[model samples]
Target: MDEKRRVAAVWLPHWPVERLYRADRRTRGKVQAPKAPLALAAPGQGGVRVTACNRTAAAAGVAPGQLVPDAMTLCPGLELRAADFAADRAALKRLALWCGRYTPWTAVDPAGIGEEPDGLMLDISGCDHLFGGEAALVADLQKRLHGFGLTVRVAVASTPGAAWALARYGTAPAFILLPGDEAAALEKLPVAALRLDDATVDGLMRLGLKRAGDLYGKPRAPITARFGRHVAQRLDEALGFAREPISPLRPPAPFRARGIFAEGLTRTEDIEEAVRLLAGELCRLLAHERRGARRLELTLFRADGEVTRLFAGTAAPSHDALHLARLFREKLAQAGDDFDAGFGIEAAMLAALATDTLAPAQDRFDAEGADAEALAQIIDRLGARLGHERIVRLEPRASHIPERAVVSVSAVRGATPAMRGWRAQVEEQMAAALAGSLARPIRLLARPEPVEAVAEVPEGPPRIFRWRRVTHRVTRAEGPERIAPEWWRRGERRTRDYYRVEDAEGRRFWLYRDGLYLRDTEGPRWYLHGVFE
Candidate 1:
């Protein structure tokens, strides 16, 4: 096992980020509640006293998910509104950012990963000198987050588990573990801090293993048999007896290019020229690094102490300077008509959010072969003009039906193909299908439209019917291929009998006759749905 170093674990206590967003909506009175509680009460703005009713607020009578009306009934006057998770999250991210001021290895607590999250984790082993020492560093962090309106706890230990347990469970005296004394230090802490499931904790509790020390003396075989090996493993890790791997959340790749205004820039044209200069410099940097950027960030630092950041990601990695500048040009065109340039802009930094290695080009190629560099440049220019969403390629989907055979996603050029096993299976199924097994159209509407029709059928597609108003006579018709709707999503839907027909002008059309003739209450209807290429 590897020797453990100084690791400090930080959790947000609760999901503070979510709480922040909730405050924003609730403050504007935009929140609709049976009786909304005020979120933005000024320091001295007096309102009715509303107390939380759990043991912490529950003991006061407030239960989680209780409606304002019901809660008011229980306490006569309960001040309650939704929690502001966004604002809380923003505050938490800011704290995470500030933690960068402490150590570059800082990351947001994992509480934001799923619904009821706890806190963040930081690996501060060798870099405590900048803030003096461990004790002083923890004190500084606590003061900062507290000033930002957060209740936080810091724990420093040799192992992540010990630090996490201390932060969440251990009392004040043992919050900061000393060197070579983890066993005695963790003895009194509750077993729940081991990150075990509720059932495991309950089962351990029933076995009289209340404190972490209680499980310390248990034999490995018996513990493994009775409570499973995870219990023993967690105990060993927390007690510094077994090794546990710490996976620090990776920050996005750092790729930045900056431009300083000779004189402060205030006009849109000045910003554009600055952007072009920065993009060109960024491209040179990317070329030097032998990588292409997939996302570009433009940060404008205003003289008024405000930062405005714009982000645009490519479907593929590219380092074309002219193409990069053009992408921002389209975005700038869409800015508000009354956009104000307060004070002036001092600097701009363009960063790459994603990147890929460009392949070395071959010296010679066949005449008919595509030029990779030319293709990339073309894609970059088109991506800039049409917007990222507009340029895409159809990726094959794993369905036997023609309509479900492919899907259009934001195209990534030269991307690694998705799961080979699944692709092989789909290809095998599609290989055996007959060309005329079903009449399929080149283009299918994203959604189906309903139409009224009097069909000559033992319940089949209509010959003469009105669709998007042009009544078409079915000269040639194909058999009905029924496609059932996915019932789990929208419940039971009308069944479709699809047919390919040539209209009066030899224009080919794909139509669907929905429902059966006099099926239930509604009559059979014809829908001119798709055009054949």
Candidate 2:
């Protein structure tokens, strides 16, 4: 048993062509001689060129990168289709995501050339035991993918580079490279198996270094000097002398619980029941770890290979299983009628994507505490039903400008990070200022409206103003209150002079001048800012 990290590379040699067959089988329920010669063509320098070919086409000598006319000459029965690069990439992503049931760490191989992503990388380090052993895991993957009409070559190796190379270039359809045997096994493959681009591979082959073994004991200085560090780096990575990390489509959660049903579940009710049990198991894990889930995800893996994922989030960290289960209940209810069981669900996984420290609370309950919990449940339910982004609340920002003083954030996050850098100072300033002036108007316009005002003095309060094409006479007026611009932050903003006044109809208005008056200069423009009840 090798203690080093293990990676599984799954290469779909004809992904661009096979994906179309898979789609046909999925939508039309069966394939009509899908083994017939097929090739995908894309517009290249010289009109259309073949980008990918199925096994039958390859057998007929119609290989990729060949001109359409040449390939047609080689294989007259070839079914040609314009390459749907986008659909192929999306299907690859979906396939990679489906592999998560085997292990959480699965990513599309980053080494694919051009716009085509043809393989997946799986970090199956400690995950082999779940499926008996590494050999079983590889066999299971190949078998399942083959059942889906995909021709796959899978290899497990200690290093991702080695696994990727072996999967594509090794003699076997599915196999494993013992951890310490990478150097020996990799040497037999072509130098291109090391994931080098075309130019580097061509350059190395011209110098008679056509095999990985040719460079095994050769001087590194000359090879690196001619090809730069990339050649040396790829060699080191393939042999496990260098480190390479695969970025997973979704990072594995710290806390998780899995459930496998003996019989496939076809009804949504059964799925909900399974989710509840899984939630209970997950909450127990969180409690034992002294952590609580802030966001949770439920993944249902169907027997037919289609996966359904549902997500729920809470306003605060929670370990209560019932509350957590209710969150997903709302999601399932929201997905009513649109949810399909496909061929029935065979396994379910619940993971806490985000978590936080949660200390135990007192058993004694208080009215305020109960109300707070009730409110959190409401927020969670609403956020789950309506999108989390749609359920938001205004958070105060440390800004002097009224327009910039508040921002809308998802209510699922009860508070921002635990930093009080400028917020503490702002709170102190606000408390001190509250004792000096009356409260601000409850009704503030989104943006200040312009008004034509006449004042007795250049810096005094307005006597009357014309706003929104309506004229009003000022019956009660207050002195001007000046506000200076935040020059340190934004230098272009002007100083403002504000006043609180009431019209003859008892409607109170707050108005401000855009800039202070200078000697004989045109007075600053006046604008109505808010209204007071």
User: For residues 186-261, could you state the per-residue lDDT of candidate 1 as single tens digits?
Assistant: 7887778777777788888998898888877778798788778888888778767798655544353466776556
User: lDDT of candidate 1?
Assistant: 0.64
Query: What shift in Å separates residue 145 of candidate 2 from its native position after superposition?
Result: 0.9
Worst 10 residues of 1 by lDDT: 36-45
What tens-digit string does per-residue lDDT give for candidate 2 at 1-533? 23379999999888888788778887989785477898999999788999999889999999888999999999999999899888887888989989998899999995544546799999998889988999988887888788888889999999998999999999999879888888999887899998888888899999999999998878989988899998888889999989998999998988888877878999878988998899999999999989989999999988767889998899989988999988888998998899988878988899999999998777655587788788888999889888888998777776666667666777888866522334775676688568664345767898999999998887788888999889999999774667765767665467777778999999999888888667324559999989998
Candidate with maximal TM-score: 2
The CA lDDT of each predicted structure is: 0.64, 0.85
RMSD for each model, in Å, please?
A: 12.9, 5.0
Off by over 4 Å in 2: 1-3, 33-35, 45-47, 110-115, 362-365, 390-409, 415-533
Sequence-dependent TM-score of model 2: 0.77
Which candidate has the highest lDDT of all? 2
